[model samples]
Target: MLAHARQLLDGSVPLPAGTARVAAAMLIRRALEELAAEWSGCPEATTRSQLVIAARRLPPTEAERACLAWFALSEACHHHAYRLPPNPVELVRWLSVVGGLPAPHP
Candidate 1:
């Protein structure tokens, strides 16, 4: 999902800037949610609150970053007439946040 989002932003995929940004944001959100579910040992990341709860378990600074990233990604994923899609920079920042999360141990 993160790779797809990177492709969307990197022009490997043909998408308008606005559309690609939103699509990338959506993909990043999915990746973040899955990471949160795993990190929290929850059955699933079924709600925004679940993600927040997961974020809160991290070290203080990381927890703050995770919460902010989740909020930004969630907002970016929505389609609202008055709102603009996230810019590449913002999406990339969220991607970094998602990437920074720990992967589940085998």
Candidate 2:
């Protein structure tokens, strides 16, 4: 997903910049949502609750940053008539942070 997001933003995917931005945000949001669910041990939890639950197990400082990014990603995923898609810089930042998450324990 991260690779795809980068491709979309970098023009490899051939999407309009704004569309690519939104698409990348959606992909990254899904990845983060899944990670939060796994960390929280509640696959069935709603996206809104997943982060809060996961934060309990995450490091104190990192959790706050993750939550802020998650919210921004969520908003970016939605189409707002009045607002434009998210900036590529924010998506790139999120990709790095999500990429840095520890691999799931077996």
Candidate 3:
């Protein structure tokens, strides 16, 4: 998902900015899902909304929390807007911080 977001933003896929925002939002949500399962131990979360609420129960860093908040808003409304598309570079940085979380111990 992160790679696809990068590809879309890098012009390899030639998609619109809003499309890239959707992909970026998805990547962030993917990170949240991982956090909800691994950090929060709520593997039953099946939807982004559930993951979002579950993530709040964990102790994410300030940056991670901010990224999650941005992701929620983007996923909820950015895809339908014509302006204020998310910046790919910022999205990449956010993914690097949030999506690059380490695996949990066995």
Candidate 4:
């Protein structure tokens, strides 16, 4: 998913607002899913809300926690069809927070 997100962000051409929105959503969603799965061993489907709750349990930095909170409430991509595409820079920051999370134990 991150790879696909990267492809969408390649900037080979100007991305449509809808395309950018989907890309941002996909990247963040995948990141949240992974974090949730790592937090809980269930490994089944999980919602963004659930992921955010799970994230709070981890020993995350304040910025990471805030980023997760933003992901939980931000509607940047939720209404892509109705609203403007999210800022690429902000999306990248969210992705960075995800990337910064500690790896799961072996």
Task: Assess each prediction's global lDDT (C-alpha) against the native.
Answer: 0.81, 0.82, 0.58, 0.60
Candidate with the larger lDDT of 1 and 3: 1
- TM-score computed on alpha carbons, candidate 3: 0.58
Return the top candidate by TM-score.
2
- What TM-score against the true fold does each predicted structure earn? 0.86, 0.91, 0.58, 0.67
Q: Give a tens-digit lDDT track for model 4, residues 1-106.
A: 6555655766653688567656666677666566667665557645555556555666657435644535642566566456667667766666666666666564
Write one digit per residue (lDDT tens) for candidate 3, span 36-99: 4654455775545444554465455643564465565455444554566666666666666654
Clashes of 4: 0
Task: Pick out the ten consecutive residues of candidate 1 with the lowest summed lDDT.
Answer: 43-52
Residue 41 alpha-carbon offset, candidate 4, angstroms:
1.2
Q: Which segments of model 3 are wrong by more than 4 Å? A: 45-83
Better of 3 and 4 by TM-score: 4
The Cα error of candidate 1 at residue 1, in Å, is 1.3
Clashes of each: 0, 0, 0, 0
